[model samples]
Target: MSDSINIVLRFALYLDLMLLFGLAAFGLYSLRGQERVSGAQLPFAPLLATTAVLGGLLSLAAMVCMTWAMSGVSDWIELWPHIEMMVWETDVGLSWTLRMVALLLAGFAVTLNKRWPTASLGLVLLGGAVALATLAWAGHGAMDEGARRSWHFITDFLHLWAAGGWVGALAAFALLLRQSEPRLAVLARTLTGFETAGAVIVVVISVTGVINYLFIVGPSITGLLDSTYGQLLALKLTLFAVMLVFAALNRFHLSPLLENARQTGEHRVAVNALRRSMVLEFSVAVVILGFVAWLGTLSPEME
Candidate 1:
């Protein structure tokens, strides 16, 4: 059914948004904290800078997909909805254009790698705010009316910020394990900090996601189990649960191994494991984005 397909699609979009922002957040945090400890040998500076630029490009693509997915056109009408006109028009439909510009600047700032505290911090704040705002139009708050909408918006924003910061730090974590690299000690410290930050972000996301479902999707338990929106939501939750599994492995099992290896002056295995885990996380993130995209298209039934 079209509805079924839409549900699947929604989950993908959600995953994509989370992954994209997650990568950016990690990049920003790493750029801020990791590089100082990493010394000049490790390429944390340029890596984070490139990730920021990639995040900008990804943000643009996501905005376009969001626009196309939301026109409410079913069947073939969905295929051709003034795509040509949008291309030619000077006035873009979404406010995300400004976000794209800001992200581009953020990318530039990072690449320049000077006075990063001010430039990078400003970019993170602005970009984070804009990223959160985009969720409103992406339907985080739009389904509800009045104060409920406001509540939904705030919760979703917090959820996003938390997730972004948490996941974004993963990039920094990844930078630590580059063969027999000497930055192992520095990487260990950075990873420890990220572990703490990630915990806080997870708690925020769980709390906010629950509030969103309660206020916007209705308070009944049955609503979460029986509806199309509920099913999609459940699926997102499931994927997140799986992501947490990998996160746990990395945090508890692998991270300790990495630290031990660093202390022992044996680094290759830990680094490789870390790299593999990160890649898996990234792949899962993509699937989650597709689901989110589909979620934006579905209506949470009120009954």
Candidate 2:
């Protein structure tokens, strides 16, 4: 029961941080000045602020749950000493503390929109990346040591950011599609602007995914089939491939069609098509994250 709760919390946190980072980064790359914070393009300040605060709360709940699981203490008073020891004595604690701080920083960063929109967005990205990177501690990377540990951590970090970027972009597009006042020009620009970044995201996810697999499961690819973790991993990879198909359709087909429709002043067909594709892609991404959260809790070495 506790394990289930932990996985759910992790999934929520993962989604939260990814959006917090990916959307902010997307705004910087795709949206022009003032549009980012002026609520004219994307409601950057309010949305990010809400996500940041929720992340902090989720982090606290996960920490308390972890402390209970580790120490077998249910009461807050009894858990205090254990919490102190873990927070001060263990690397996991350190990472959790830093994650909390990053979330807080993001919360504060979002509030600075009036004074420094671009700077605030940059700060949010920094905070989101830090918070996201800290999740590596909860994964297989934490078990490694020495030089191999550093290398593994780097791969994990890159893999996370790339995945987050893709997830966040999907969410941003979905949100925009739902807007009452559809700015077709801005939508077209955003779709077109993301081509290069989208390619980079795919390449990074693929390369780092393979590197991460090698680090976690080694060369014994056939051995993985016997374990539940391996099964989930396989499912995740298959879904990712499906996700690629959607992306390709959007990029090579739907996006161009939208541009043509924009010129023709009749984009309802293209818009509706993109809306369906994005919803499906985002749904797949959600399932993948759930698998990720579950896989993190299971041992790949299970035979």
Candidate 3:
């Protein structure tokens, strides 16, 4: 039961932080001129702020749950000392502190979004990155030492950011598609921007994924089938591949159809197709995140 709670918290935290950061980053890069300001069609600012707030709350809950799991103490009064010890004397605690601080600032940034769009977006982006990066301290990377630990963390961080970028952009894309009378021009532009960004994200995720796998599971293919961690990793990769197929359809078929439809001033077909594809892709990403959360709770070396 405790393990289930911990996994749920971790999954929630991961998804929230990714949306918070990825949405902000997408707004900064994809939206242009008036599109980014107060009168913009998309409600990205409010959505980002909401995600940030949720991420903050999830971070707090995750901290509590982690302390409970580590100390094996459930009573609030009895667990106080153990929680205090973890907070003051551990790397996870320090990382949690950093994430909380960043989340607070990010929440504040949302309030200023209307008054100062550029500055608020910048703050949210930076804060989100910090909050997301801190997750590395509590994951498999933290098990290493010295230089290997540093490298492991670097890969983990990059992998996280890349995954966040992809997942977040999919969310934004879905929301945009839901707009009452979708703007073909705006959709085309956003899709084009994502195409470029997605390329980088895919490359980064692929490279860091291989690096992380080597670090955690070494070169043994048999280990993948023998352990829970490896099995979950394989499942993640399979889902990712399915996502990739959907992405290719979006880029090659649906995106081009959108462009042609825009030219012909008839885009409902393309729009609906893209929307359905995004829904599937987003669903797959969520499943992958679940696998990741579960994998984090198991030890690769134990196999």
Candidate 4:
């Protein structure tokens, strides 16, 4: 039944990633685009907001599943004294910390919108910093070591932040599109800011991802492709590639459509195209996250 257990574990991890990234995309879109549009449509704010709330909730569940799987694999399986039990004791403090940071950012996104740049910047920096720092002692980063370990930690931290930013911005963008507002200029500017931030985050995540492969999977390419651990990593990478494709389509094709709408006054077409692209992108991100959670629990081929 080890195979069955592994399958179940993979399934749970997949769900967790999907919920985390999917919610992030929804949140990002709402934060970035919601205020730029009219209110006649479903109002992208509520849908994306719901996505964040649900995504956060699901992410918490994913974490629990991760803890369970990790404990089982490590043979720390004393049912009564498992780390899973301590999640509410002292270990969960970090989880709460990150959640608080996320909530604070969400609040700022709601209240600030565009009126108070200073306040928004301060909150973003503070929340992002705290969220990133906490990861050093939290789940995956806690296990890294040496010079390469720090590299892995920083990259993972940056990846989380970037993922949050991209997903949150996506949520905001969705709202803007839903409003079908005739103001294409506002949407274009917001999308530009999002693209810039996303580009940086993606670079950081990619660099860190490579470092992680080197440190965790080792130097041998054969180790990664020939082992169970490597196979799982490959699967996660595949999902990530798919998410990247969707993100590219949204960034290149749909974003330009928004720009064109502003110039040509075809607001409806731009909004429809952007909205559809974002939704697809968000869905793919969620699936990728699930793979991430599962991968975290298994032993690397090098190990």
The lDDT values for all models are 0.60, 0.92, 0.87, 0.55
Reference-based TM-score of each model: 0.72, 0.98, 0.97, 0.65
What's the count of clashing pairs in each model shown?
26, 0, 0, 25
Question: Where does candidate 3 have its weakest 10-residue lDDT segment?
Answer: 33-42
Residue 17's lDDT within candidate 1 is 39
Cα RMSD to native, each candidate? Answer: 5.3, 1.0, 1.3, 6.1
Candidate 3 ranges with C-alpha deviation above 4 Å: 301-303
Top-scoring candidate (lDDT): 2
Residue ranges of candidate 1 with Cα displaced over 4 Å: 1-94, 115-118, 178-182, 223-226
Instruction: Give one digit per residue, the lDDT tens place, for model 3 in 1-303.
Output: 888998999899888898888888888889876676644756866787788888878887888888888878889999889878887899998888899899988888888877788788889889999999998987889999999999999999999999998888999899889887887898998998788899999999999999998888787787567877777888889999999999999989999999999999998999999999999999999999999888888887565
For model 3, what is the C-alpha lDDT against the true structure?
Answer: 0.87
Task: Return the lDDT, model 1, position 26.
Answer: 53
What lDDT score goes with residue 60 in model 4?
56
Candidate 4 Cα errors over 4 Å, as ranges: 1-121, 132-138, 145-150, 180-182
lDDT string, candidate 1, 97-133, tens digits: 6656655665555544444543554554465456445
